[model samples]
Every structure is written in C-alpha cells, then in structure tokens.
Target: MHIQLLGGFRLDCGPGPVHVVPGARRLLALLALRDSPVPRRVAAALLWPDTTERRAGACLRSSLWRLVKPETPLIVVTEDALVLGAEVDVDFRRACAFAAAPGASPEAVTMLKADLLPGWWQPWVEAERDWWHQARLRALEVLSDRFRVSGDRHHAYQAALAAVQTDPLRESAHRTLVELHLADGNPAQAVRQYQSYRTRLRAELGLEPSSHIHELVRPLLR
Candidate 1:
C-alpha cells in the first residue's frame, strides 16, 4: 500500500487508482505515530473532539470502511486499537527517522521533498506539518555535518543548497550555504549568499542582517 501525507491524504492499493476521502488523512496521522497503538476512543476525540461519542465512533468506523476493497486491507482494527495494515508503509515516518539518523542517505534526503500535507488546513494537520518541517531541517543539519567531516565539499554544497530550497527564509539555511561555500574555497559565492540574505531581510522585515552574519561574511567581501 502507498500512503501519501504530503497533500491532503491519499491511499493506493493494487490494481486501482488512489482513493480520496475526507477523514482518511486524520486516520493516517494517528497511525503514523510510530508503534504506538492509538486507542479507539482517542482517535475518535482527535478527529471529532467536539462531537458526541456516538457520532465520533460512527465517523471513525465510516472512515475506516472507506478504505475497504476485496483485494486490499488498508487498515486493521483490533479489539480496541487501529493501525495501518501490515502491507502499508508510512513514508513520512520513514523519512523522519532516516533524516534524524547520523549519516546521510539518498533515501533520507529524498524523503524531505516537500512540507508535509501542503494542502491540508485542519488544526491537527498543522501540528503534524510543523513536526515534519522541524524534523526535515534537523536531518539536513545532520547531513551537512557528515559531509563537512568527510571533506565531501561537492555533496556538502549540494546538501546545503537543497536545504535552503526547502526553507529559504530560515537564516540557518543561508548560514549553512555561507559556511559550505567558504569551506569549499568559494568565498565569492558565500558573499553573494550573504548579500541575497541582506536584501531579503531588509525587504521582508525592514531589518538588517544579524551582526553575527555580517561579521562572518566581512572577510569574504571582494
């Protein structure tokens, strides 16, 4: 089973196009919380907290059934819990884990292609989306550290470049690019990034770049 959490939620199974439904995304988020088995009642509360218990239970049941197909079991319900079926793989979780680990792997970097569920707007969606953002950034930092240690200047440049693309506003992204360029003996590129950051900060916030940043790039001015 293929599960998508990058935009609203979508689940795909064998021999059929992906299914889209309301509430399925919530169910997927509950299941994505690692090995923790979400209690039936808790899932009900999160998805329909303001509703009556009876109504919430009914909604959960309906959402679960929507994934049913003769050929695939997308979800499994036990005596009192719910989980993504054994056949299903949760990519966000995998991506988060890989990104957090010590070494950089292709799979880990690929996992952070976009922010989590760019299309969803529910409160719960925001919570998970924030989580993935912070997690992905942390992974990029780890990759940068690994590359710097190994003297992999090219990969280091590439990783920092990708990180900034993911979060252009993050001062750390600009900072990382600056450091990577300096280490790669490209101080001119570092100065260019600094100037870009200066313009962005002035335009967006009407403030100057931090003194620390100004200090770092001072020697590189050509």
Candidate 2:
C-alpha cells in the first residue's frame, strides 16, 4: 500500500485508490507522517485540540471506526498506541530520502517538486510543511551545485531556477541561479535575475540583496 502526503493525501492498494473521508483523512495523514506508534491519548489530543480529553478520545474512536475496512486494514491499534500498518509506504519519507542521496535522478527530482500537503492549516501539519519546504530547497541547491561542477549546465540551471522559484526571497537561491546564468554565458540573464530579485526583495522586505549576492553579479554587470 502507498500513502502519499506530498502535494496531497492519497492511499492506494493493489486494487486501486481507497476512498477516505475528510475527518478520517486527517487522522490517517498524521499517522502516516509520524511513522511510529503514538500513544492513544497523544494522538487523540493532537487531532482534536479544541476538545476535552474525553471528547477527543471519542472522536478518535469514531474516526478509527470509519477507517476500518474488511478487505484492508489500514491501521494497527495496540492497547495504548496507534500506528499505520507496517506495509504502508509514505511518499514524503521516500522523497526526503531521495533528496539526501549522493546522485540525482529524474524520479527523485520529480518527487522533490511536490510540496507537503499544500493548504493544510492544522498546527500539527505546519512544522512538517516547513520542514519539507526547507529540505527541498536545500536539495535543489545541492543538486544544482553538483550538476554545475559536473559540466551539466542545463540541468544545473534547471535546478537553480527551481530553488529560486521555490523560495523567491531566499538570496542564496538567487545567487546560485545568477552564478549558473553567468556560467552558461548568459550575463544579461544573470543581471536580469539579480535585478528581479533586488526589486522583489526591496518591495517585500524593504531590504537589498546581500553583499555576497551582489558580488556574484558585479563582474558580469560591469
């Protein structure tokens, strides 16, 4: 069984996609992300923060009931702990692993493109979402550097561009992208990118690009 949390939440078994109700979906999402046995009380409390302990436990029980399927058991509930079935594979974990690997592949890059559960506003999800955003950006920058060092300018540019697009306010991303443009004999493009970043950074944060970023494009600009 595959549980996808990046981009969105989906569960697929051998047959096909399995339908999960909204309330249960949140519970399943948390379980898939945690990837370990959580105490029943803790799980209940996290999922239903506004409710009393008794009410939260009841809600957890209800959601667990809704998740039960005769054909496939999606969860493993112990006397005091809850976890997703051992057979389940979470895409977020897989993508994170791929990002840290030594070499890049088409599949890894594709997987890295997806954000973790975009538009999910739960407190439980926010930290994980931020974690993914930072992880992906770092991975993109690393791959860009590696590709650039290997004389693969096109892929290097693509990776650097992706990093900048992922976080427009990240000066390091813009610097890397500008370096790639200059390396590829596109000084005008490098200057344009630097100017674009300068404009946006000024408008958004009322700040200028750092000295390091300026230095990267200074030679080309002159």
Candidate 3:
C-alpha cells in the first residue's frame, strides 16, 4: 500500500485507490507522518484540539474504526497508541529524504514540487505544510546551484525561478535567481529581479532589502 500526503492525501491498496473520509484521511496522514506509534490521547488532541478531550477521543476512535476492514487494515490500534500499518509507504518521507541529498534525480525533483496536503487548515497540518514548503524551496536552491555549476544553465534558471515562486519573500531564493541571471550575462535581468524583490519586500513587510542583497546587484546598477 502507498500513501501520498504531498499535493493531497491518497491511499492506494494495489487494486485501486481507497476511499477515505476527511477526518480519517487526516488521521492516517498524521500517523504516516509520525512514522511511529503515537499516544492515542495526543493524536486525538492534536487532530481535534477545539473539542473537549472526551469528544476528541471519541472522534479519533471513530476515524480509526473506519480505517479497518475485513480484507486490509490501514492502521494499527493498540491499547494506548495508534500507528500506520507496516505495509504502508508514505511519499512525504521519501521526498524529504531525496530533497536533503546533495543532488536529486528529475523524478525526485518532480516529487518535491508538490505542496503538502494543500487546503488543510488544521494547525498541525499548517505547520507541516510550511516545513515542506521551506524544504522544497531549499532543495530547489540546491538543485539550481548544482545545475549552474554543471553548465546546465536552462535547468538552473528554471529551478531558481521555482524557488522564488515557492517563497517570494525569501531573499535567498531571489538571490539565487539574480546570481543565475548574472552568470548568464544578463545584468539587466539581474537588476530587474533585485528591484522586484525589493519592491515586494518593502510592500509586504515595510522593510528594505539587506545590504548583502544590495551588494549583489550594485555592479549591475553601475
């Protein structure tokens, strides 16, 4: 069985995709992400923090029960904890491992491109989502740098631009894009990129670009 948490939540049990309710999906995702047994109380509280503890526990029980079937069980329920079945494979774990490596294959890069569980508003999900976003942005930056050094300028530019798009306010990504432009003998484009970052930074945070960033584009300005 394969479970996908990036882009969205999905479960494939070989025959086809398994249908899961939203609460159950979230439960399975949380378990898959933890990749270890989680205390039932803790899982319930994290998933339904707004509800009373008893109600949250009841909700968790219902979700866990829904994951059980005569043919296959997706979750393992213990006296005090819950965990994904041993047979399950989670995509987020694989993507994170690949992203942290020195260089990623094209397929790995494609996997990293997805946003984690898009549209989920739970606090835990949101935090994990932010983590994945930053992870992918960093991975893209690494990929861009590697491509630039290896004389693959076109792919380098695309990767850098992807990092910028992932987090427009991230100065490092913008810097990478600028560096790529400068390397390609496009000083004008580098200046344009810096100016755009400066404008957005000032508008969004009422702040100026750092001196470090200014230094990067100063030569182009002259």
Candidate 4:
C-alpha cells in the first residue's frame, strides 16, 4: 500500500484507491505522519480537541474501526496505541529525505513541488505542513544553485522563480533569482528583479530590502 500525503491524501491499495470518510482520512494521515505508535488518548485528544475526552475516544475508535478490514488493514490498533500498518509507504517521507540533501534530481524536485494536504485546516496539520513547505523552499533554492553551477541556466531560472513564487518575502529566494539574472548576462533584468522585490517588501512590511540584498545588486548598479 502507498499513501500520498503531498498535494492531497490518497490511499492506493492493490486493486484501486480506497474510499474513506474525512474523519478516517484524517486519522490515517495523522498516524502515517506521526510514523510511530501514538498513544490512544493523545491521538484522540489531538484529533478532536473540542470534544469531551469520552466523545473524542469514541470518535477515534469509530474511525479506527472504519479504517480496518480483514483483508486490508490500514492501521494497527492496540489497547493502548494506534499506528499505520507496516506495509504503507508515504511519499512525503521520501521527498523530505531527498530535500535534506544538497542537490536534487529532476524527479526529486517534482516530488518536492507539492504542498502538503492543501486546504486542510486541522490544527495538527499546520505544523507538519509548515515543515514541508520550508523544506521544499530550501530544496528549490539548493536545486537552483546546483543548476546554476552546472550551467543549466534555464532550469536554474525556473527553480529560482519557483522559490520566489512560493515565498515572495524570502530574501534568499529573491537573491537567487537576482543572481540567476546576473549570471545570464542580464544586469538590467537583475536590477529590475531587485527593484520589484524592494517594492513588494516595502508595501507589505513597511521595510526596506536587507543589506545583503542591496550588496548583491550594488556592483550592477555601478
């Protein structure tokens, strides 16, 4: 069984995709992401914080029951804890591992392109989503640098633009894009990019671009 948590939550069993309720999906996602046996009480409380303890526990049990079947068990439920089945493969883990490395292959970059469970507003999902978002941003930046060093100017530019689009306020991403333009023998474009970043930063945060950014474009200005 393979589970896709990036972009959206999907469970693919051998025959086809498994259809599950939203609560069951959340439960499965939480268990898969935790990647370890979570205490029953803790899982219940986190999954249903607004409910009474008894109600939360009941909800957890019901979700677990719906997720399990004699032929295809998605979760391992013990008296004290719950965990994803051993056979499940999660794509997010693979992307995270690849992102931690300095350079990434095109395939790895594609895998990192997805946002984690976009539009899911669960409180527990927020931290994990933020973690993947930052990881992917860093991966894109690293990939851009690697492409630049390898003389793949077009790909480098695309990667840099991707990083900028992902987080406009990230000065490092803007710097990468600026450097890409400079490397391509387009000082005019570099200056334009820097000016755009400066304008956006001032309008959004009432702040100037950092000295590092100014220094990067200083030589071109002269």
Taking the tens digit of each residue's C-alpha lDDT, what string does model 2 give over 3-82? 89988888887878888887789988999888678899998999899989999999999999987464556788899999
What stretches of model 2 exceed 4 Å from their correct place?
68-72
How does model 2 fare in lDDT?
0.84
Write one digit per residue (lDDT tens) for candidate 3, span 1-222.
889888888888877898988788889889988867999999999989999999999999898777746355678889999988887889998888878884734666677778888888888888888888888988988888888888888877777787777789999879888887888789999999999999999999999998878999997688
Which has the better lDDT: candidate 2, or candidate 4?
Answer: 4
Candidate 3 structure, TM-score to reference = 0.86
For 126-194, candidate 1 gives per-residue lDDT tens digits of: 787778777777777778778778877666666667687777767776887888777768888889999
lDDT of 4 by residue, 54-105 (tens): 9999998888777746355678888899888887889988888878984646
The lDDT of each candidate is: 0.73, 0.84, 0.84, 0.85
Q: 88, model 1: CA deviation in Å?
A: 1.6
Clashing pairs in 4: none
Backbone clash numbers for all candidates listed: 1, 0, 0, 0
User: Which candidate has the highest lDDT of all?
Assistant: 4
Which 10-residue window in model 4 sums to the lowest lDDT?
64-73
TM-score of each: 0.83, 0.92, 0.86, 0.89
Clashes counted in candidate 2 amount to 0
Candidate 4 has a TM-score of: 0.89
